[model samples]
Target chain A: MISSIFSQLFQTLLIVVLAPLLLGWVNQCRAWLQNKRGAGVLQPYRVLHKLFHKDAVLADNASSLFRTAPYIQFACMVLVASIVPMVATDLPFAAAADVIALVGLFALARLFAALAAMDIGTAFGSMGARREMLVASLAEPALLMILFTPALIAHSTSLTTIVEALAHREFVLYPSLAFAAVAFAMVALAENARIPVDNPATHLELTMIHEAMILEYSARHLALIEWASAIKLSNYSAIGIALFLPWGIASAGDWNAVPLALAVLFVKLLLGGAGLALLETLSAKLRIFRAPEFLGTAFLLAVLGMLMLEL
Target chain B: MATFTGQLINFLAALLLLIAFAMLSQRRILSLIHLFAWQGFILALSTTVVAYSTHQPHLYYSAFLTLVLKAFLLPWILHRLIIRLNIKWDVETMINVPTTMLVGIALVIFAFNLAAPISQLADTITRSTLGIAMASVLLSFLMMITRHKAVAQVVGFLAMENGLFFAATSATYGMPMVVELGIALDVLVGTFIFGIFFFQIRETFDSLDIKNLEKLKED
Candidate 1:
């Protein structure tokens, strides 16, 4: 039991520390693909350090909720890291929350962040909040529907349970899963503010989505928000790994397998990060009005996946 | 494990159903034709899988005919027609997308319910996918009713034919070779006639939106 707690703490610290490194890797890859000498992979770490040491400058109109939202969001992300079985399947919190609770956690963070964005009463803030809600409303249903497919297959809502069932099953091509996987990839990209949905690097103040929401923050608050976003990305990648490729994560009885599991987790994150960068590099940003149809297709694909499983 | 080929046939039928859903949701005229070709391609491949598994020599011919006529010849004709007619326009839907999709889901459930007894009576390894074929047919019919462009409706009609061919292949195996040939020729001739009618409609109405036909009916 003590070991399990230690493992949980270690996993949490490891992912939080490594999250920005993954971000830096993706940015470097995107730069290389775009034919520019990019910032080094350590760039995000340095930026985080510099921001944390500097003083925070709040908007004059900020409410108390605005001050606490970043901590709430970062805490939510860290909690998600602990709940998801990243490097080991022996987490004490593995069964603490089911997949629905996991989704609720995401919604909780989004609500506070959006509330805080609107708390400032700025046009960009409210506009960005509304846009974020729109994307979240659409993405949330598709995400739950995607989880339903695997949940049905495993007969459980626990993320750990689902991963174990999928990992132990003999590898056979599930056509339903193929459809769901593609739809899940789309939702992940959209939810994470990745390219073709929202450009993470773009600074066109008039049309930015994620950036506009947090435009009021500076220094330590900005650093915490940035770190939280990085953790959110890592959390999503870990969920994807658990659901689709849970092969190498060490099960509870196998303490000796932990190092191997960590190695496998590292390789998977590297590939997932590079692949995301390539996708962001290749696809052009779509028009804002087209987002509904884009997510509509994802919803449809997810529904199709569920139907295929039922059939 | 006892029925590998049977499982593969079911997989292919699922693919066919997915393509049908894609076509129903699609809005671009060019992309609709591409999806139609893909449906035809899947139909031919499923037929070959059925033929090879069941040792039916005539199905090979049906597969070849489908590959040549539907997948290659028909899409080529439609592509040339669109290029020549300068009708590179987005398809207009009569009903909204979400409603159409809901209706489509209802139709799929209804198709499975409708195919239940019929599938039990059939004696093929791929009989289980008959419901999917029926769903594909209903979905294509939905496409026809929803779209406003004449070319899109025509493509919808051809996709319906593809679904029917899939049903024939999945239910009792391929149809008689002569009937298959006759249907193939009829579809080709019908395309030519439709191509001519597009020009007439465009000349008379100045656009390919079939809603103009309602004006004529009222007059």
Candidate 2:
């Protein structure tokens, strides 16, 4: 039992620490693709370290919610890290590894941060909150449908079970999963505030969704929130990997199987990061009004996946 | 091991059904959101109970999700929406209170009948309560259809989700973590979008009455 706890703690720390590095890698790759020297891969770590030592300045009118947002965001991300099958699929807390619960963690964090944004009563904050919700509204159904496909296939909702089922080649050529995959990718892009949903790199008020909301946060609070955001991006990527790839994850009861699992996980993360950067580079941000249509399409695809499964 | 927990699960399931009915009959938007929160609370409790009984850790996460999203986050968003939209007054309902109550009863009966075969198939501890859960879902849907105010409809929508969550917990233990997370994200995002919709409705029609939106249907 003690060894399991230690392993779990170690895995959580690895995810939290490695999350920023992954973000930096994505940024650097994007820069290289754009033919610019770009910020170094270690830049995010430097920025985080620098911010952690600074004092946070709160707005006089800021409510308790604002003060609590950073902690809540960080805590929720940590919770998410704990649930995701990062280093090993045989996590001690794998029983808590329900996809719907994981989505709830993300939602809880988003809700808090959005509330914090609106608490200051700034126009940008409210606007950002509104847009963020818009993106989320359509994304939810699509996500549900995507998850339903896998649940139906495995006849169980547990990620570990599903991963094992897939790794063991329990089923083949599920057309439903393919449709769900596309739909999931769309929802992921929107949920993470990527291009075609909201540009993560831009600061323009008219176009920003995620950035505008955090414009008021600064110092350590900003750093934590930023780090949490990066972790979230990584988490979503890992989620995609677990559902789509599901190979090479070591099952529980084999301590010796961890190293191989870790290596495979690392390779998946790298490929996933590069793929995300390439997708972002190739896509343009959709207009705010058009976002619903994008997510609507995703929802329909997910439904189609479910229908196919039923058939 | 099984019978005692099964009985407790049934009791909690009944409480959840009671809350669903209360939410359906509520006319005030604020109170409806409050009831929705209570419903979420019950869901969380029942989920926790199920988790403990079944030794399923994921159910605990499911309970946590219900607590945070339904009990805390969504209600908070609804409260803010009401305040921002200045919609604290009594909301308009499409159907009369008595008629709605009668319809709700009919829905309950229909739910039991419809869920009978399915519930019989379920060997879970909370199998008998599956009918109540389906009834709650149908009743919440009815509430949505009978409410003429946008806020009321949103509350009903949320309550429906609560019923679905209860079904998952009681009948099947809980959904996958990925699916739960996805639903939680969806609900949070849905609430925010609905909040914005409330604002837009007020701005466009100068009232919170969703009947005004019907004008678009005619056009």
Candidate 3:
């Protein structure tokens, strides 16, 4: 009991502190791929430190929701980190939240972020909120279908149960999971506002999605949102690991295996981060109108995955 | 142990269905042909596996025929035809892509429900894959109807043939070897005739879009 609690606390803290490092690693990789010297892997930490030390500036018309949105978003992301079975599946929080609840938590955070974006009444903020909603509506169904593919195989919606089912199964190629992985990668790219959906590094007002929503934020509020987004990216990567390549994750109450599990998770994340950078490097951003087709293809792929399993 | 090969066959069938969807939504004529080639290659691979597992030696010939005719020869000919014709535009869909995808999904469901009873009566280890084979066929037919370009439709037609070959392998362990050979010759001859027709049509209409053929009836 005590060890699981300790492990859970350790994972939560690790995710909070290391999430920015993952972001920085991805950025560094992108830089290397583009043939430029990177700002280094610790750049996110420096930016967070600078933001936290400065006073936040708010618009005169900003509502309380605007002030509180960052905290809600940050708390939601942390809760998600705690719930997902990252290095270990034995955490107490895993039983409390299944995949559905995890999605709901993400939706709640997005709802707050969109609401807050619209709160300022700025043209860019409202436009960003609308676009975010459009993406969420398309992406959420695909995400659900992707999760349900493994869920059906495991016969449970709980992430731990699904992980246990997939990890312990005899080596057999599942064409359905292959399709689901492709669909999940597409949804993840879009949900995280990565290149091909929305370029994170670009500030061109016409093309930005996530960046536009937070254009008015400065100092700590921006910092918190940035941190929350980093965590969100990690959460998605962890979910993907838990679902598809879950061989190395420590099972519940496997205290002795935690160290090995941590090593495996680190290697997986490192490879996954580099893979994300490579994908971003290879693909150009789609026209905003084309995002629907990209995500629609994702939805169809996920549905196809489910249908294959049914067959 | 018996279920292992069954699972692998299912996986391949799922891949065939995925390729069908990809071909359905693909816009470029060149990539469409590429996808068609991949579909043929997977079909050949699956047939080879089925042959090895079931000890049906004649199915091996069928597999080789699929590999050469569908995967290599057909794609090579189509590639040359497109290059010779100087056709580079995205294959226009009659409806939008998303709507076509939705209709494709509906067709898949219909195909599954349509095949379920027939699949239940089959005794092959790959009997479960019958629905996927049927779905791919229907999806290719959907692709055929939705595409406006002649080359795209022909690729769709070839993909539909691939689906039928998969169905034969899964359902009845392939047709008799002579019939397989005959069908192969027929497909090759049909492609040659289609190639001739392509030039004749382009010479008459100055374009490959089939919509231009409607003017002949108007006169």
Candidate 4:
């Protein structure tokens, strides 16, 4: 029991610290792909460290919700990090690792951030919140359909069990999972505020969704929110790994296998980050009106996955 | 543990059905959204209790999702939408309240009948409540159909989803984490879209009455 607790604590710490590094890595990759010398891989960590030491600056109209958004966002991401099966499948709180709950964590963060954005009563903030919510609503159903495909095969909603089942190679060629995977990827892209949904790199108000909401925030508050966003990105990647690539996860009651599991996870994160950057680079931001159709396509694909499962 | 869980689920299912009835008979949009929130709270409480009783840790997350989305976030959004759209004073009904209530009762009966066969296949302790859940869903749908206001219709739609979520939890423990997360995202996004729709509706008709939308429907 003590060992499990220790491992969980270590894993949580690892994710919190490594999240910034991963973000920097993605940025560096994106820049390299664009044929420019990017910022150093440790740039995110440096920025975060600097931000934490600075005082927060808030707009005069900012309410309590705005003041509290950073903390809430940080807490939500931390909660999500704890639930994911990062280094080991048999996590201390593996039972709490329901996919739905993790989504709730994301929702919690999004809700606070969006609310904070609107609390300031800025046109851009409300607009961003509106757009964010629109994307979330459509993305969610498709995500649920995708999950049903996997749950049908694993016969349990527990992430640990699902990972173990997949690792054991219980079955092969889940056409439903394949479709769900594509839908999930689309939802993930939108949820994370990536390309074809909203550009992470752009600052234009008309095209901005995530950035516009954060425009009013400054200093430490901005840093925490940014750090949380990085963690969120990593968390989504980890979720993808847990669901689609469950091979390297160490089973519960296997403490001796953790190091190997950690090494495998690092490799997966690297590949996932690179792939995300590449996808972002290849895709142009979709028009605001086209987002629903993009998400609708995801929803259809997800439903297709569910229908395939019945076949 | 099983008995406690079974009783708790039964009580929650009953509460959900009652709320469904309330939503159906409600003439005020504000009250309907409040009742919908109360239903979400009950769903969250029951999910938590079931998670505790069965040692299904993931259900706790499900409960949290319910609390966040149904109880707090969605309601808050609706309230803001109501204020912004300036529809706080008017709530029009397509069907008379008493007639809507009677139709809701009939829908409930139909739901129970439809759910009976499916419930028989479920092995969970809350298996019997699946019928109640399905009934609530149908009644919520009936309420949606009977409401002439856009906001009320959205409330009914959300209520229907609440019933479906309850059924998912009670009949099958809970959905997979990914699906739950996905649905939660959908709900959050859906609310935003609906909020935008409410604005558009008001802009078009200068009122939230869905009767105006009928003009757009071809003969």
Candidate 5:
């Protein structure tokens, strides 16, 4: 009993600490793919440390929501980190929320972020807010459909139940899951502001979506939001791993398998991060107007995946 | 082995339907032709698998004919037609892509509903794939109706044929070898005639858009 509690605590702590490292690793891989020497893998930590030490600069008319939005976003991400079965499926926090609730948490964070973006009434901020909402509206349905594909197969909406069912099942190729994975990858790219949807590295005022909204933040508030974004990226990666590749995650009361699970999780993340970098390098950013078509295709693929399973 | 074969056939069928949707939404003429070729390749592959698993020796010949004619020869002809016509970058669509995609989805659902009863009555190892086969046919027909360029229409027509071939293979262990051979000859001759007609249309209208042919109608 005590070991379960200890493992839960350990998993939560690991998610929080490892998120920024994952971001740093993806960025480093991107740089390497572009044939540039990268800042070390610890660059995100250094940046976070620097931001936390500086004073926050706020707008003269900034509201309380503006000040607290960063914290809310950060907290939501942390809660999500705890809920997803990353290293182990038996974490206590996994019971607190099912897949739908987890999606709600993401929407909540996004709503807060968008509300805060429009609070100061800057032109760029409002524009960014509109674009972000547009992407979210299109992506959210597809996200739910993608989640439901596995839920239908496992006969449960709880992430832990789904993971356990899939992990213990006999080996068989599921074509519906193949469609769901493709749809999931597209939605993830769009939701995370990655290349082909919104370029994360670009700060061009006209083309930037995520950065334009947070343009006014600095110091501690900026640090928290950036950290939250990192956590969000890792959150998505963990969810993908949980759904499609849930084999190595340790089940509850299996203390002997925890070490091996951790190693497998690490290797999966490493390969996944590099694969993401390769994809980003190979594709160019779509024009802003084309984003709807991209997300629309994702939605269609997800629906087709569900239909394949049913019909 | 039998179960694996069934699963593999289902996977290939899903891919066939997906390629049909891709062709439906694609705007570039060259890309449309490429997707058509890919659809043919997958169709031939699925036919080969069905042949191997069901111990039908004639399907092996049908698959070989489909692979050579639909996958290689037809695409090669279309590529050369596009080069001679100088219309490689055409992107005109009578309906926007997203709306067309929504309509395509509806067609797929309708096809599945329509095929369910028919598939249930069939006693083949590949019966489950009949719905996907029908969906691809409807989607290809939708593509044919939505595009303005004559070349895209031709590609869509050929893709519709692909869906029909898939349907025949999946539903009935393929047509008799003689009928398959005759249809292959018909498609090859039809493609040649279509190529000649494209030139005639281009020479008469000075463009490849089928809408221009409206001038031939009397007011």
Candidate 6:
């Protein structure tokens, strides 16, 4: 029992620590693919540290609600990161919340952030708030529908149960899963404010959705939000891996299973980060109005995936 | 009968249904053609799979004919016809897309319910796929009704034939060899006639929109 606690703690620390590294790796890969000398992979960590040490600057009209939102969002992310079965299955904490609650966790974080954005009363912030809500309203349903396929396949909604079922099942290519994976990958990219949904690297003000919402944040508030976004990206990638590529994760209670699982996770993260960067570099961002159509396609694919499960 | 092959055939049948839905909702004429061709390709693949597993030789020839006639020849001919007609842009539908999709879903459920008893009567390895085959035919018919252009309707008509052909292979191991040959000739000749009809329609009305044909009926 004590070892389970220790492992859960380790998993929490691992998700928080690796989140920024994954973001930095994607950025570095994007730069390299664009034929430019890139910022090092440790750049996000340095930015986080610098922002933490700086003094926070608040608007004259800032509310207590605005001041409290960054922490709430950050806490939600940490809690979500802690519960998802990343390195080990059958973790004692996996039962605390299932996949649906995990989605609710994400939505809670977005709600806090959007509320904070509106609290500032700035034009850009409100516009960004509206856009973020629009994107989320479309994305959340697709996200739930995407989870339905694996949940149905595993016959459970708990993350660990689903992961264990996939790890133990005999291997065959599933059409429903293939369609869901594609849809989930698209949603993840959109939810993380990546390319073809919203460019993470663009500086043009009108082209921004995520960055606009954070225009008022400075110092550690910015640090926490930035870290939360990184955590969001890592959380999504881990969920995708747990569903579509379920091998090498340790479910046994043996103490010796830890090292191989960690090594496997590192390799998976590295490949996932590089592939995300490659895709972001290849695709152009769509017009804001067209985002609904993109998410609609994801929804269509998810619906088809569920229907395919029946056939 | 390996379970793996059974599952694989089921997966392909689902893909055929997916393409059928795509055809039903697709707005662009070019993409509708592509979806039709994809249906043909999946149909051919499923047939080949069934033939290999069931030790049927004639289904292989029908599969080849399907690949050439539906996948390659018809799409190529349709693409050429549209480019020559310059009517490749617009494909108006009778109803909005969401309504069409909802009705398509209802049709799929109905097909599943209808095919249940019939599938139990068949002894083929892919008998369970009968529902999907029927769903594809209904979806193609839906596409034909919703589409406004003559060319799009023609593609929909051809896609319905593809579904019917898929239904034959899955239910009874395909029709006789002579019947298969006759259908192939009929489809090829039909496409050519449709091509000539397209030119005459354009020449007579200066457009390919079938709504103009309503004027002839009224007069």
Supply candidate 3's per-residue lDDT for A4: 84
Question: Which tens-of-lDDT digit does each residue in A181-228 have in candidate 3?
Answer: 999999999999999999999889898999989999999999999999
How far residue B57's Cα lies from its native spot in candidate 3, in Å, is 0.3
Lowest lDDT block of 10, candidate 6 chain B: B210-219
In the predicted model 5, the residue pairs found to clash are none
Q: What TM-scores does chain A show, candidate by candidate in order?
A: 0.98, 0.96, 0.99, 0.96, 0.98, 0.98
Model 4 DockQ class: incorrect
- Lowest lDDT sum, 10 consecutive residues, model 2 chain A, at A302-311
DockQ of each: 0.45, 0.01, 0.77, 0.02, 0.72, 0.46
lDDT of 5 at B203: 93
> Whole-model Cα lDDT per candidate?
0.88, 0.81, 0.92, 0.81, 0.92, 0.89
Interface RMSD of each: 2.0, 16.8, 1.2, 16.5, 1.0, 2.2
User: Model 6 clash pairs?
Assistant: none
Encode model 5's per-residue lDDT on A168-201: one tens digit a residue: 8998878999999999999999999999989998
Candidate 1 local lDDT, A1-311, one digit each (tens): 99988888888898899999999999999989989999999999999999999999888989999999999999999999899988887788867898999899999999988999999999899998998898899999999988888888899999888888888888666767777888889999889998767889877875578998999989988899999999999999999899888899988757899999999999999999999999998899888777777887788778877777644
Candidate 2 chain B, poorest ten consecutive residues by summed lDDT: B96-105
lDDT of 6 at A218: 99
For this target, which candidate reaches the highest TM-score against the unseen true structure? 5
lDDT of 5 at A124: 88
Residue B118 displacement (Å), model 5: 2.0
| C-alpha lDDT of residue B57 in model 6 | 92
Q: Is candidate 1 or candidate 5 better by DockQ?
A: 5
**lDDT by residue (tens digit), candidate 6, A1-311:** 88888888888889999899999999999999999899899999999999999999999999998999999999999998887888888478778899999999999999999999999899989998899999999999999999999999999999889998998878876888988998999899889999988988776778899988999999999999999999999999889999988888888475687799889999999999999989988899999988887887788778778776765
Q: Which ten residues in a row have the lowest lDDT in candidate 5 chain B?
A: B210-219
